[model samples]
Target chain A: MSTALLHTGTHENQTSLAKKKLLPYWLLAPGIIWLTIFFLVPIYQLISTSTQTQGYGIGTYVQTYRFANFMDAITSSKAQLFRSFEYAFLATCFALIISYPLAYAVAFKSGRWKNTLLVLIVAPFFCSFLLRTVAWEQILGEQGFVIKTLRFLHIMGAQGHLTATPFAVVAGLTYNFLPFMTLPLYASLERIDIRMMEASGDLYANALTTFRRVTVPLSMPGVVAGTLLTFIPAAGDYINAELLGNPGTKMIGNVIEARYLAIVDYPGAAALSLILMVTILILVMAYVKRAGTDELV
Target chain B: MVDASSSAHGDLILKNLTKTFGEFVAVDDLDLVIPEGSFFALLGPSGCGKTTTLRMVAGLEEPTSGTIFIGKSEITYEKPYKRPVNTVFQNYALFPHLSIYENIAFGLRRRGVKDVDDQVQKALDLVELTHLASRKPNQLSGGQQQRIALARAIVNRPALLLLDEPLGALDLKLRRAMQIELKWIQTEVGITFVHVTHDQEEAMTMADTIAVMNEGKIEQMGSPADLYDNPQTSFVANFLGQSNLIKGSIVDSSGESAVVDVFGTKIGLPVLRNHAHDSSVLVGIRPEKIRIAPAGTQMNGNILEGGVISDASYIGVSTQYQVEMPWGQELMVFEQNDDGTPPLSKGDSVVLSWSPIFTFGLAGDQDVNAGSEAHPESE
Candidate 1:
């Protein structure tokens, strides 16, 4: 009887231990289920549709497994794809150049006003992104103070227009994504021991060299994060090209939008979307490899 | 330009150095000359302006109204980068991104010096961390990182190496080891090291000359033995080590010894050790200097009578006795265990005696408890 009781007790202990072991999986269930329904399911549907061919009737698609649609989409919208990357790359570089100094000033030099300055860096998020872009449009418009002042100072010719140009599109992207760059830069720069900069100075590095060798290199994690955050969204963006850019400044996102809404080409749109996603993945991986975040931690 | 060969190697002199942060003065009209190649220490409690003085010397902080010279060249207005001074910061501020090799090579490379490999390798070997050259700073332990920080600065071969509490983060055993190593390194490199630390033992272990700072002024500056044996101020007497101060007044001054009256008990103090501004003085004695014996037993030196052992604690190496004298002042006595005398217990009547040369007198008006506790910086 004692042997049987011991066996039963061991069995119960094993079952309870099993429950404890499964707790983490049960906790992860909600996230896994949500992703399966919302993200994974959509991806599967997108992949299946990208290979489909048009049916005999309008608004219909047949799964013909025609991989040629990807090539067709790429050939037609290749310019837009390259333009998107170029604009995004330029916008990311501009945002980084503008944000790093702003972040450094706020982090080290602000002292008592640090919190106020940080709030200012992030305060623009309270206004709608579209509204801020529209404000920029007015500021750079022909009759706006910026253009008039530049024309008066002879910095710009009388025929020079700020709106509907590649410059305007890149500027809009940079302005919209600035906070994304600045916040991370501020976090990393603020976390730097101020003494490190002092040590650099003591070690015979001038102010500019210290910034380049010590300050810039030490803030690499923030730089990488900021660049990715700005570049990713900017690459797939269509709003700036639509509102502030000329027809020549059209990006791949605009082409995808046109393919789906204006032309009713679902397969082609799906193929283009998959191509854009893959291209960004490859570029990001290559960039991360070359940027070398091995020492970031 | 700081010609490292000539201008950097001479005495570093600070003339009328004063730094004020608005309403409060951090370092007030301080003048000091740290002799060339000496391992000098600015020893003080936290915020006693020791670090501020060091920073002024390093060109990190601009003095309010002072001129600094590395032998005749005025460096007060010079930028930090232009000065031939490098600092091993308190926190070992190694560049987190750089490997140990690159960190040591930084100063050498910044000066546009070619072939930094030999110097970097020598520095890594000097710190005895040649194996850790390829690893990043975070991977190293606190002690290792500290050595790297030292290596990073010394690779530049700066004339002055300022160590700002470089061992403050280490455990006691490691801190002790680092103290000896730092002293050895200073001697080997022959740099005029201006070390700043609140730790008295660390300062005493390494510094050839120590400047004990208190509240924006030097309380006393002397060799370690001189400061410990002949402190001129109550702050120095209590801060350097433990001191048993008894209120006394000078009764007679005639030969080599001056007689002091402490609550009707006559005590002998050396005439030269008297630093009191007036006849009123606080007689100070170190705890270990005093010997304790049962009452009525014979004792030599300046003797105190009619005292009872109120407290006796037997630590491994020594016995500590707190004797309540007839005057109601409890005098501390530390007896080494090497003496074969039977251990005295609490409540036993005892006599405290020490050589009169150990008795130093300070100004009576100074606070007796000034340096017992850690004073808040700047307050």
Candidate 2:
């Protein structure tokens, strides 16, 4: 009789346990189904398309498993690939250099004006992205004051112009994504207790030493997050290169865009797109790991 | 365990130190002298200027009009890093990114010390945290991090170490253990330490001299026993410990003794010991100093009769009673539970008695509860 009672208790517990275990999966069903349909299925299609070969007609392809398409795309457009990384790296560095002090001021010194200053930092976003890029075009144009000042200072050659140059492209990238860099840095710096800085001074460190030893290291998480936010999108950007840069400064993004649309090369575009996506994923994984900010990943 | 007369090289003297934020005064015309190698405590409820005074000494805050001297060098205008003082912040402010070893070595490295490892290792050993030398500060428990903060400040060997509620973040058990450990460390190092805390027990346990502050001024400054036995202000009486203050007026004054009348009874006060401002005075007595007995018992010295027990609480080592006197004032009395008498219940008529020598006098013109009012924690 005791064995029978124990068996009944176990049977009841098993039913409840099964129901409890199914609750989380049932809650997760909507998100999982959405991602599978909208994200994973497209990625699968892209992978399959990347291995296809060009067909006899325009806008057509065959499932030939032409893995060599990726190699061909890389060899042909290696300069653009390298330039994309170079421009992105330089822009990220400039954004960081410019944002650190601004973020610090907003975080620590703005006092009653902190909110107003933050709004000012984000005010440019009210305009469309393309409109902002076009605005930069006018500012850096040959007829604009910036170009005139460069000429007056003899910083540029007699016939030199600011627009349609590598400098303009990088500048536009820096300006467009600056808030992305500033906000995270402001968040991290704001979280630093002022007591820590005072304690640093109490420990015989001068102001500069305190900044180097304490302020910079404590804000590394913000630095990692800001750099990723700026660099990842900047690397794949094509608009700046198209409008502000000359042909010599073209990036892999411009090539992939032209291959897909202007050149009508679907297989080549798919392979190039796949290579870009995979390379970014690998680089991001390695960077986050190296930064020791695993929580960001 | 701290002595005020020894180690004459590291004394701190402050004169007319004042700090004001806009129209509000934070530290008002404060004057102090901390003897060399003495563990002095600036004890007070919050907003009493103890921390402001400490900050002025550390050069973190500039005094409006004052002179600060460390063994005779006027350092009022010196920058914080230039001052020969360090502070252990209230939150333990350990650098989150640095290991325990590096955090301790920071000062040495900044000053370009040649042998950092030895100094850092010695400090680690001083705090008994050599085992955690390789761990980052965030990886350690609050108690261990507190020790690291101490080690970090002490490793610099500054002339004065200002600790701003360093144990305020720890659990009760850890705080008690650290109090003894801090006292031991002060003795071991023999460095002049100026500690600021709101905890009366912590100050009494660790300080050689405590300056009880109220309203940005020193209410009383003396050794622990002296302050407890003879508090000059009602603020000091209530802030340091619980006091049963009886409202009274001086009936007679003489060379060595004065008589104060409370209700219908005349209680004698020690003239030299009392600090009464006028005929109006508040007679004060600590709870433990008063003895309670059955209503008809004979009493000598100072006595209060016809008090009914209002409340009784059994607290293991002692029984605390709230007695309602005939004058409609409730007085607290603590009786030792040594004789194993039956516990007194509420409504039992009792007589309270204590020696006249234990009574103190404070100016009654002031609010009896002025400095003793309970305030939420202020920074």
Candidate 3:
């Protein structure tokens, strides 16, 4: 009788746990289905359209396997490829440097002002990205306050112009991706126990030592997530380079857009898009391996 | 590994220490001198400033005013690391990212100590965690994690070690085991161990001296036996252990004895108070000191006639009885169950008696109310 009772109790506990596990999936099913339809299906269609042959066997693959196209794009447009990566890398580094302290202040120092600071950080999202980027162009234009200030400070020479420079493009990218970096870093830093720092200090580590040993290691998940979010999007961004950069500052995104829309080269555009996607996939996989993906989320 | 500069019998002296969080004073004008090489416990209920005092000493908190000294050195402005102190947090606060070996080596590494591997191995051996040195805190049991926390703190060999309810998270059996283990570890290390706990039994069993705190003040401070036997205040009497506080007026008083009428029964107490003619006082007696006999039995010394109102609970080696006296006073009596079981039953008439020397008198005031109010809430 005791054994039977124990079995029933165990069965009841297992049923409860199973039901709890099912509830989350039940709630998540609709979102997964929506993504599958809108995002996954379209991506699958893009891959199939890039590889499928029309009327002949493997004709599209054969035509596009002009793997030489990838080489040609890189060799002929090496400037644009390097410029895009350089601008994206610089922009990501700038965003990380500025956002880490901002997120730290919001997560640890602001205390009761945390919610208000977070709201302020996210307030830029209320404006359209194009409008915000356009606003920066006006601010850095010849007649703008920055140019006037620099001229007043005797820093701008006769040839000094903020518009149409790689600096402008990188700045624009950093501005566009600042929120992405700040929000994830803010989340991770906020979840860190304040006592951990106190414990470090109590163990004879100064502030800098504690930050290097404890704070940076613990916040790596956020750093990886923020880097991926900013770098991937910035690499493919065309608006900032188009609006704020010179003709010499054209990025890979501009080339892909020109191939698809201006030049009407659908195969080339798809191939370039696939390459960008693969690069991002490789980066994400590496990040997931280093810092557990669960921690990232 | 202890800091040799402050190692001459590292005694801690706090002078007029006070801390306030906004309008609430957590610790008020606290002055305590803890000698070196002694296990001292700060005993109090939650929010009584015992934890705040411990934190101030650990340098986790800054006092609103006053100074602290460790072995003739004024360390009031010193950071926790600069001071010769380490803390074992209540939750054991072991670094989750590091293994036990790395956790123990953290302080030594920060201090740039040589031979870290040998020191880590020694600490692991001291805590009996040599086999589990590679294990993470999450992978270990609660008791094992507690030992690792102790190992982490003592490996640094600071002049003082502070523990804030270190065994509070363990199960009863584990807590009991760790209590003895911690006491033995403190003896083996021979360091100044300032432990904070709300468990009176834990304090009594482990501490060389116990300071009972209440409402941001040290209500009483002495050895566990001193606090238990001759509690100066009613708060000390009730806070340290279970006591029946009988309210009465002193009708007769002499040098070291007083006759008090409690609920129309004249009970002779062995404690004398100045100006006790018409002064109201409280008589405190531990339940174990009171003996229970079957009715119609002759007894000696402050005998009370009562009937057993509750069933006798056989708590391992002792039986506790709740006897209801004629004056509606419910008295608890603990009888040793040496032979086997209790000889009394529920609703059986019984005689409850205690010796005069077993009872002590405390001044009747708000302190008595404070003791009574704080005692039941802790349990």
Candidate 4:
């Protein structure tokens, strides 16, 4: 009778414990389902398509495993891949340099003007990305105000245009991704204890030394996050190149778009998309290993 | 290491330093001379400008006027980093990313000190944190973090070490332990420590000299015993410990003593040389100094008759009684709980008396002992 009572008690306790464990999962069910359907499934399909081919079983995988396509993507089409990387890297660097001071001003220096400055930084996003890019095209075209000013200054000829250049593509990318860099950096810098800097200064460290030793190290997580945000999108972005850039500045995204739409090569597009996602995932994982995400948050 | 040059002559001197934040004056003109190798405490209640005074001395806060000297060098307008002082913040503010070793070594690195390993190790050993040198700040307890902060500051061997409520964050037991440790460290390092705190007991126990501040001014600056036994101001008397302020008028002043009349009670208080005549006075007597007797008993010294309207509450080693006199004045007397025996209970009439020498007469009209405002009788 005691054994039976113990068994029944254990069963009841297990049931209650199970309910406690299941409650959180029940609450999280909708989000998990949405992520699975939208993101995970699409990624899985891309991977599967990359590995399959029409001729031999796993032929595409074998060919891709040789990395000839990657080399071809890099070398062929008039140095398209290399030029794309150069433009994206430059854009990401420029964005970082410009955004840091802006973030610092918004986060620490602006004081009562912080909210207003942040609103201004985010106001560019009020218009859609496509619309903004098109607007940039209009402003940088041959008849645009910038070209007209440059010609008037005698810095450029009358026919000088900012459109269809790598510069225009990078400028567009920087404008589009600036908020991504600034917001995270601002968040990170804002949470830094101001007293720490004061303490450092009191310890005889000059302003420059304090910044290098205390401020920069403390804001590493934000730097990593901003870099990831800007780099990933800039690497894959083809819209800027398509709208304002010439054929030479077309990125991986353009190649993928052409393969899927213009060439009707779904397999090649899927393969390229898979490679890009994997590369980004690897880089992000490496970053997370170096700078823990908890610090950023 | 104690800088022999500074040790020969006291490092810090604040001459009439004042700091005003807009309309609110945080620190009124304050003058203090902190000797080298002394643990000085800026003790006061919150918003009394104790922290502000310390910060000004450290050059963290610029004084509105007056001058500051460190080792005979004027550093009134110098920036904080340029001043020969370092501060251990209340929260420790240990660099979270750095290990204990790195945190201690940070200042050294900034100063470009060579062979920092020895200095870092010595600092860790001084704080008894050698074994935990590799651990991050978050992995350490509050006390450990506090020690790390101390280690970080002393690693630089600064001329003056400013501690801004360093022990305020610790638990009572830990705080007590740290107080001793801090004193020991200060003595061992022989560095002048200017500690800011609102805790009276902490000031009494740790500080060699206590400067009691009130409303941006130093009301009284003296040794702990001097301030406690002979509080010059009412603010000091009430702030340092509980004191019964008996409102009285100076009936007569003779030589260095005065006879003050409190209602119908006449008490003689030793007056200072500067005591004013015909002015209202406050007779400040500590609770412990006041003795209680059963009603109708003839007391040996100056006595006031009252009834024990409230029973004594046994507080570990002492029993506190609330006695109400016939004139409607309430006096609190504390009796030692000897041999765990109980004392008189409620509704018992008692007489309260103290020796004439124990009573301190403060010039009440000066608003020194009155704290915020003048008593109506004195007004």
Cα RMSDs, all models:
2.8, 3.9, 4.7, 4.5
Give per-model TM-scores.
0.94, 0.94, 0.90, 0.91
Go through the candidates in order and give each one's DockQ: 0.76, 0.51, 0.39, 0.50
What is each predicted model's overall lDDT from 0 to 1? 0.90, 0.88, 0.83, 0.81
Task: State the lDDT of candidate 1 residue by residue for B280-360, as single tens digits.
Answer: 999999999998888998988888889999998999799998899887888888899996877899999988899998999
TM-score, candidate number 4:
0.91
| Tens-place lDDT digits, model 3, residues A69-184 | 55555566677767777899999999999999999999989979999999999999999999999999999999899999999999998679998998999999999999999999
RMSD versus native structure for model 3: 4.7
Give stretches of model 1 more than 4 Å off: A1-19, A134-160, B1-3, B375-379
| Model 2 lDDT per residue over A1-297, tens place | 999999999999999999999999999999999999999999898889888887888888899998999999899989998899899999999999999999999999999999999999999889988999998999999788898998999998779988899999999999999999999999999998888789888777889989998898888888988999999999999999998999999998999999989998877888888888888889989998898853321
Query: Chain A TM-scores, all candidates?
Result: 0.93, 0.90, 0.81, 0.85
Candidate 1, fnat value? Answer: 0.94
Best by lDDT: 1
What overall lDDT, based on C-alpha atoms, would model 1 receive against the true structure? 0.90
Tens-digit lDDT string for candidate 4 (B1-379): 2231233246588888889999999988888888888999998777889888888877778899889987677889887777678899989888887788999998888777777899999999999989998988989999999999999999888888999999988999998998998989999989889999888888888999999888888888999998988887777777787778777888777757677888887877877622334568777888899878778887866788756656577687888888787767677788887755458788987888888788886666654344423221122
lDDT of 1 at B223: 100
